[model samples]
Target: MSSISIVPTDPQRWPLHVNAGVHHWQYLDLAASTKQPQSVAEKYFLGLLTELPNLPVASNFQDASRNGFRFYQKLQLNDGHWGCAYGGPSFLLAGSVIAMYISETEIPAEWKIEIIQYLSNTVNKDGGWGLHFAGDTTVFATALYYIALRILGLEPTEPLVSKARARLLELGGATAVPQWGKVWLALLNLYSWSAVNPIPPEFWLLPDWVPFHPWRWWVQCRVVYLPVSYLYANKVTKPLNPLLQSLRQEIFTRPFEEIDFNRFRNTTAPTDLKKPLSPLLRAANVLLRFWENYIRPDWLA
Candidate 1:
C-alpha cells in the first residue's frame, strides 16, 4: 500500500516560478516554519471517500459524468488552470537526477524521499523500469534509474538495487544503452566518450539552409542536442570519485578496464531501439566519425 498528498502552499512565495506561460515548481521541506493549506481537491477526495466508504457506484452515464466533473472541478487551481504531475517518460527524472548529482546540487529532503518512493513503487515485476509507466523494461531506463537510485544514497546491495543490477546485466549491461543514454553516461564519466558516436558541435557551423542543419530539425530534437553537441565536443565529464568508480564496476558485466568500449559505440540493446537506423543515417555517422578523428579543428570545437 502507498499514499500521496497534494502539496499545499503559496506557489508565488515558495519555489514556483512562472515566466510567460511556463511554470517551474520546486518542492521544499519547510517543516513547521511554513503554513501548508489544504487543497480543495484533497478536501473533496477525503470527504467523498469518507461519505462513500464502499466507493460511489454510478448507475448511469449521467451519474458518472456528473461525478467526474465534480471531482475534476476540485482540481482546478486558483490561477484558472489545471495542473497535474507529468507521469510519462520515466527517463526524464533519471536525467534530472544525473544532472543534479554531477553539479553537486542537493535535492530537498521531501523531494528526495518522494523520488525514491516513486522509483521503487514503479519498478516492474522483472525488477527494472521502462520508457514509460506501462511500457516494458529496457537497458536505457534500467541502467539510468539504477545509477540514479545509487546517487540518491541507496546501497548497491539493497534488494531493489540488486534486482535492477541483475536485470541490467541480463540485458547486456549499461553498454547496451541507446545513443542518447550513452551521452548521459559519458557526462557522468560512467561510460567513455569514445563509446559514443559523434555529436559534433561543428554541425552548428553549417548554414541554416543546409539540408542537415540543426535549425531544420524538429524543435524538441534541436534544443536537446544543441547543448549536447557542445558537451560532447569538449568531452566534458564530472570528476571521478569512489562512488562513480564503484558504479563503473557494478553496471558492467566484465571488468571496466577490460571492456572494449569502441565496440559498443553504435550498439544499442534490442529492447531499447524504438526505430532502426536508416542507411543514410548510418553513412552520416561514419562520415562524422572520420571527420572527428582526422579533419575536425580544435579552434572550431
Candidate 2:
C-alpha cells in the first residue's frame, strides 16, 4: 500500500498521521530517510497506485457546478470540517490505554489491532519508535510504548517485542527517557517517583498576575502540568503486578535494582534533548526540589 510522508515545521519533529486529511501544510517522504525527520507541519505522499474515478461529464456547466458542490457536501462533517483518523501516534496509545484501564472500559479487539498496527507500521526501520512515528526513535517514546504493549498482553517472544526491547536497551534504557515518560512510569509504579523532577502543585496557588503563572503557558502544557503536579504532590502511584515486575527487568539496560534512580531526574538521552533546558529553568527546578524535599512550610501543604 502507498503511504504519505509527514513533515513538521520543526524539520526535526512531526507526529505521524496528524488529523489525517485536514491540512494547509506540506507533505514529506518517510522513505527518503527514516532517520531524517520532517518539518513540523509537513506530510508527503507517494505516487498513486490507481486512477481515481472522475465524475461523468455534466450536461452543461451548471450541472458540473452542482455535482462539485454535492461532492464537497459529502466530505463535510457536522462541525463543518472533514474528519480524519489522527490515529497514528504511539505515545497517545499509552495515555489512552491507561485512561481506559482506569475507567474500567472495555477496548474492543479491533481497537487493540489498530493500535498495534499503527505502532508496527510507523516505528523506525531500526525497530524503535519516536515521539511521533515520523520523528527519531527516542528512549521516551520507546519506553512508554514498550510498557504499553506489555500491558496489552503482547508476549516477549513476539518478534516485534524482541526488536523493540533491543532498541530500548540500545537507547540506554528507561533511565534515558525524559521527564514526562518518567512520570507515566512512576504512575504505574514501574519506575520510582524519586527519579522524576519536582512538579510541586503549590505553583497552582500562585496569583494569576504573576508573570510565570502556569496559566500563562500554552493550554496543553498548563493542563498537563496541573494534573501531573497534583499527582506528584501526592506521590500518587498504582499497585504493581507480575507483568510490570517483569517489565522492570526487561526494559532497562542496567539491573533495575543497582541503578540510582535519583541521578536521572533531569537526565534525558542525547537524541531526545531537542531543546536544551535553559540554565534558568534548571536552577529553578533545583531550588524547587530542595523546597519539595525539606524546607517547604506546612501551611503550604
Candidate 3:
C-alpha cells in the first residue's frame, strides 16, 4: 500500500504512464500469488485498467500445447493438489464461510481485509453487489454478501453495510431470498428452520433403483446437498452468537414473528430463477415435503 510519486515532463502523458505502471504492479502481485504469467496479468489489468486487445495467434499446435502445459504448471499447488479459481456465482462464498464457521475454523485477519477490499472494489455503481461480479444487483446475492461482511465483524451501521442492508430490505428482505439463502440464514440462526424446504439426508439411503435417489443428481449438487440434508434433518444451528442476534434485524423485511414461513418454500429471487423450474424437479420437491413431515423415521432423524 505504498504511494507512488510522479514527475511529469509532459502533463498530458504523465497520468497515463503513471497509472499504467501502478496497475501493472498491482496485477503483477495478483499474478504472482496465483502463479500466472506477466502477460496474463497484463491482459486482465488492461480490461479494467485500460483497453483489452485480441489474443495473439499460436504459430502451430506444438506452440499451443506448450502454452497449455505452462498454464497447467502454474496451477499446480506445492502440496500436490491443484489450485483453481472458482469465480462464477458469488453466493458460493456464503456457503464456504458458513461451513468454516460450523467447523470452528478461524479466518486469518489478512484474508478478512482482502475479502472486504475485494467486495468494496467490485461493488456496482448504484452501491450494491450482484450474484456474480458481472451480474445485476440481486436480493439474495447482496444480502448474503452483506451478512458475510457483518460476520467478519463489520458494524451493521457502517455506511457500506447499511446501504447493502437497505437495498436488501427494499428488495423484500430475507423472506424473498432463494432456497440456498434460506439455508445459510437458518444455519446462522437468522431465519427460522420452518422457512427452508425440507432436505433429509435419509434421502441418501434410498435404493439405487429409486428414481429420485440422491446419487442420480449432478455430482456437485449431490455432494453439497448430502451434508446440507444431514444438518437440516437434525435441525442443526449454531448457538446464537451476537452476530446472529443483530442479523435478525439486519436481514428481515418484517419483525421475525410476522414472516410467513410456509409461503417461501418455493420462493426464489428473480435473478436466481433465470431458468424455469422443471416439472420433474417440482414433482420431486412435492415428494420430499411429504417424506419430510410424515414418512422420515426417528431412526433416520
Candidate 4:
C-alpha cells in the first residue's frame, strides 16, 4: 500500500500577517517529504484520549459546557476556525478531472493515487458510485467517475474499472446519464452535443422581468447554466484521441457509430431521473432545436 502523510502549513503568525487567518493542509506521499505535523494541540488531545479516566458525569450545565469546550478547543486551528472534510457530492471531482484531461493537464502521481483510493473506498456494493457517497448508484456518477479513472490512466481491464463499466452498462451505459453528465461527456468528444437539449445563450439576454429569464434562476442554477449555455450554443468538443475512441466503445450499449445520441438526450436513466421533464420544458426543447437548425445566428454563437 502507498503511504501518505498529512502536512499542515506553518502558522506562527496566523490571524495577523500574510499567512494570517489561513489554514491549509495537504496530503503528500513519502517521496515528497516524510515530515508530519507536530501540532501541540493534536498531541495534547491524542494523549488525553489515550489516558482518559472515567469520572462522575458532569453534575451541572456549566461543567458539561466547560468540558465540551475543553475537548473541542484543541481541534480549533490557530486561525480561529475548525477544519472538516467537506465532501459528499461526487460529480465535482469527476468533472474537474474531465476538465484537466481536456486541457491536457498532467495529474500529479500523488493526486492520482489519492483519487483512486477515494473512488475505491466510495464505490457502492453494486460496483458504481452515486450522487453522494451514501446515495444509491446512478449512471451520472458511475459513468463520469469511470471516465475520470480512465483519464487517470487506469486500463479498462483494471478490476475496479471493469466493475464500474459493468455497472454503467447495467444502468444503460453513458447515454443514460443525465443532462450534466451528457455535457461532460460531450466536452470530451465521447458523446455528441447534438443529442443534448439546447441551453440557449440567448436566454441570458432576456430581460430580468421575463418569468423564465436566466437571471431569475436560483443562484447555483444561474451561474452554472450561464457558461453551460455558451458552451452548448457553440457546441464545444475536444479533439478526439485513441483513448476517447476506446471510451466511446466502452461506455455505450451499442456501437458508438450506431448509437443515436440525439435519441438519448432526453433518455435519462430511470435511476438517475428524480423528476421527469415537464411538458413545457419539452416544448421549449423542440423550439430550441428548431432555432438551432435554422433561426440561430452564427455571430451570436
Which candidate number has the best lDDT? 1
Residue 173 local lDDT, model 2: 89
* Candidate 3: tens digits of C-alpha lDDT, residues 121-227: 67776656788888888877788888877766678777777888887777777786777788888888877778787787877777999987889999988988988
Model 2: CA > 4 A from native: 1-72, 79-82, 102-105
lDDT of each candidate versus the true structure: 0.80, 0.71, 0.68, 0.79
Angstrom error at residue 216, model 2: 0.9
Model 4: per-residue lDDT, tens digit, 1-301?
1222323322321121114645333444444433554354544432333233343478899889988876676567677766544467887889879988888887766567667878988999999999999999999999999999888878888888899999999888988889999999999998888889988888877777899998887997899899888888788899988999899899989999988888887888998999999999999899999998898788776
Would you list the rank order by lDDT, best first? 1, 4, 2, 3
Worst 10 residues of 3 by lDDT: 8-17
Q: On TM-score, who's better, 1 or 3?
A: 1
In model 4, which regions exceed 4 Å deviation? Answer: 1-83
> In candidate 2, what are the lDDT values of residues 207-231, reduced to their tens digit?
9999989989999789889988988
Give me the runs in candidate 1 sitting further than 4 Å from their true place.
Answer: 1-34, 41-80
- Pairs of residues clashing in candidate 4: 15-20, 15-21
**TM-score sort, best first:** 1, 4, 2, 3
TM-score of each: 0.81, 0.74, 0.74, 0.81
